[model samples]
Target: MVKTARPRGRPPKDADPAPMEDVLQAALHSFATHGFNGVSVRTLNRELGVSHNLLHQRYGSKEGIWRTAVDWGFGQLTEKLSAADDESAPPLDRLRTFIRTFIHVSAEHPELLRLMNIEGGEPSDRLDYISERFIEPQMARFQQIWDELAKRGETKDVPQEVMYFMITSGGGAMFASRALTERLFTSRPLEPEHYAAYADQFTDLIMGALKD
Candidate 1:
């Protein structure tokens, strides 16, 4: 019989790791659910039922896994959020793009915010990694637009953080807390159209309030 081929670099004792993307997604969920300290590489291996050293072999440690996973999740949001950054677009139009895009993506990947919410409870190196890498950069871009609107008297002097809360806690709250929404709004359809409608409505309310 022809010899069977073995996957390269997957030593005798070490089984092949899942696709990196899938691994990161699962790791993100685990971190979101249990918090960083509550989970370990062994925990993930057990959860995946792979070789005990599989994650460690790939990630080197829990910190590495957390970084990889967090980056993977935020990378998706960052890409979609980029659609709002048309330099030729007017300031107000860009701002609307930013807000509505955020809502749509939040609806699509609530896990991104969920992971942040979990890490937000207490400050740690993990928190620093996320804040410095993802949170601060995204907020900085939005902050610049908000300042321009304030200068034009297009927006109130509402604290930037407060506006952020309005978006996250106000419009995105349903997706962020999926369990409650599923229970409360049994008839609601989670779809692209639904995301667009909510984003448009929320953006209108905020834009109107700013103009008022």
Candidate 2:
């Protein structure tokens, strides 16, 4: 009988940008479909169409991939927010722009939000990295905008955290309740009109909350 040799150690770290992105995309899909608990290296490798070595080489583990996926999602959000020409508009306009963009991006990339919710509960290194890098920067930018609006008397004197949650909750609800909405309402995917109605209501809610 032939004897098998001892197993080697872990593969080299993934350093290529393209393959890294591919793996990230697969992880995002897994998280969206099954939530955090549902993803695994075997499934990820299968979905990515890469070898187990390749997956491990790139992300180390499922947790690492989840972290990177969350970061990528937040990065996409930052890009969407930045691309809007209405950044200089009034606070309410800014809020509207963000809501519309948020819905558009979320509809396009539901996996990202699902991954975000999955990684949110774990106190892992990737979570800390995302919190420090992506979330903090975004919050600071929002706070500056809020301060500007406050000065202009467009916004009430509310704590920054409260404002952040209020804005985030709109997006969160749409994402979190998406399945429920789809099940109870029409089966057709969200259209511009659907998002528009939601955005309008969200904007009105924010305005009402801030009005003196």
Question: TM per model?
Answer: 0.87, 0.71
Which RMSD values do the candidates have, in order?
3.4, 7.7
* Distance from true location, Cα of 13 in model 1, Å: 9.4
Q: Which ten residues in a row are the worst by lDDT in model 2? A: 10-19
* The candidate that achieves the highest TM-score relative to the unseen native structure: 1
lDDT of 2 by residue, 91-178 (tens): 7677556656665666556665555566677786656876797778767766667777778887679887776656665555555567
All candidates' lDDT scores?
0.81, 0.67
Clash count in backbone of candidate 2: 0
User: What value does the lDDT take at residue 108 in candidate 1?
Assistant: 82
Clashing pairs in 1: none
